[model samples]
Target: MEAANLCAIIAHVDRVSIGKRLAEARDAAGMTQDSVARAVGLERTAIVLLEKGDRNLKVPELVQIAQVLGRPLSYFVETPVPAAVSRRSAPSLAHASTRVLDIEIDQFALDVRALVRLGLLSGAERDARARVPRSHRAAEDAATSFRRRLGLDSQSPVLNLGRVCETAGLYTFAAALGESGPDGACIEVADDSGTVGAAVINGDAGSGRRRMTLAHELGHWLFGDAYDHGASRDSERMISSFAVHFLAPRAGVQKVWSENSNSPIRDRALAVGVEFQLSWSATVGQLMNLALISHAQHDDLKLREPRAGDYLRLGLSWVEELEAPYLSPGFMAACLTGYTEEKLTEARVLGLLRGRLDASQLPQIEARSLEDLRQAFMGHGG
Candidate 1:
């Protein structure tokens, strides 16, 4: 393509991928072009130029921008660019390997939402209007009210925590949000690092670790919401506390322990793990938080942390065989509002799904059926 045409194509892709208006989605999604530019390793002006169809972009550059936008590469070229000149066919490009478990995690989040809407669970997104408090107590109160509004008992064990998060409008993804931050974050998935889920469990971690990581991130979403900008050890602890309370409420843990005084706290913890479908470490954390186990006991248990891989394996098995589909509310919202693959593809070429996924991949998937591409990408039986 000619230089001017290339620039126009780039601008058009940005408009579609990011939405009709780049400024609007960026503002609404709470992002700055500079931040996005930095994430994509481009000059700030380059972002502006690209957004305005004034910069000529190479395919590789387009791919980087798409990653920043939280979209696949197929998003950019499937329609406007003629099929004869397309870089690659949709199925071949879609077949590029991804972490299967990661895709499963994203799909799981989606299924969870489906379950909630089906009346299998109850929850809601944290109000975008609620005042985020600096005080710990205030944050807790806000979190409690959020729980109550979602019809979740303050002290009830969360039977399906992941499902609860999806019902709250988070887009769970397999990709980690980088190393500097916590295991995951709740930022605007597309506008930020393309992460939508409560947390991004490190793809490299064993399954059990991923599960804990997910719970940890879920704690953030439940308490911190999208307004909280950064992650910290203190914030992590507070969210951990929130996760414990949500999973094994103080009252509930006390009630269980009261019935098993003769049983060792470790044994009690194990039982709680089974009853609440939480990890044993999580159960122990609940005991420590509730003062049922002494600090020394808590420390001892911590010294003998259970293998996260074991827990992850069991959890995956359960999710696949017994648990219902975990759908994402965000995906549902996008689908319901007519944000189809074709639309996303248009955005990709224009640089809208710029920072989300590889722009090159967008065209491949956009030209192919999502189901066919999903099967090729994931090797999923269905």
Candidate 2:
């Protein structure tokens, strides 16, 4: 009787530990206990008890809660507890509350953690952050230096910013951060192997706008400011300068300007916008800063922004590849590999993919039953 009572106490303690994690994840997801209860078809009081560790959680109930919280089941069951991810916002969005953005970023980090644990993804060494003074000129110089490091010529357009970032050891993803949310966010996490940097861009933003946000976040990562509690106005300005010059180097802009010397100032700005994949406003700003166009020309050109037709007419297609809630190719590939190897179940794989890939889209595979897992474990015993 005493042994049975002890077993009961042990089980209760486990559930209590899980309850604590659930509460933490709910808060990180910006969900109220009542909201989670409603989403899980439970009464508010039930959620309160569950989180308080006063009640047992069934497997099915936990599964439903996992879906609502946007977390993997393993995250709740894993030992050593999940590390708390810090919220780091872009300077432009420092004023706005980033609860939703924080949720997406946190989920992405969890997915990365799972992949790395499964041996599906390799850990990367942390890159040293660049030190740039709090001046626009210094920022531009740092941008030029970074461009050189990437082996990009002054005239090269970064056709694949996402891939470039990944190659540079940044795990970049996209999330649909609605219209009012931040343009992007970034954070670096440390694991047993090493540290990894991840950034989430607002996939809902325009292609040019999205790319700019990504570049801006990349600047934060390079400057090692993604871990800062809040970005200062001066830091934001320097990073903005770095991003602009990083995307549209002066020498490249000069070359394009010289190529279109015969075109009107407005036309030249459009050409630069297309070539560098910069937003209309950024293009005009670059032209003005380069002294390629007068301040008055800059003002007029900004108003006479290029239309959608202008981009299509100029042979630039709207690339939806980076749309929000999207995963990087490498990450997606690792998830798929883990699924095919029977290391991850369908539900877990779907969670890791963030619903970007449907179950129907997944390749059919025979999943191991509980008995099979038990037998495999027994076989491994000496």
Best by lDDT: 2
Off by over 4 Å in 2: 1-39, 49-56, 68-71, 74-84, 88-97, 126-129, 226-233, 312-321, 363-382
Tens digits of per-residue lDDT for model 1 on 1-382? 1233455565555444333233333343346889878887888897787666566666666666655654444334323212211212224321122232232233234333333433333444355454334454554565566577669775565544455666665545445423322343333222111233323344444333345555556655554433444444365556555554555555666776776678766666655665555655676766776667888898898777655464454342222211112223444334323324333223423332212435344434336778878887787564
Supply every candidate's count of residue pairs whose N, Cα or C atoms clash at under 3 angstroms: 53, 0
Q: Clashing residue pairs, candidate 2? A: none
Cα displacement (angstroms), candidate 1, residue 197, comes to 7.8
lDDT of each: 0.48, 0.75
| Cα lDDT, model 2, residue 265 | 71
What TM-score, over all chains together, does every model reach?
0.49, 0.79
lDDT of 2 by residue, 104-140 (tens): 6666776676677678777664445555347888888
Report the C-alpha displacement of residue 283, candidate 1, in angstroms: 2.8
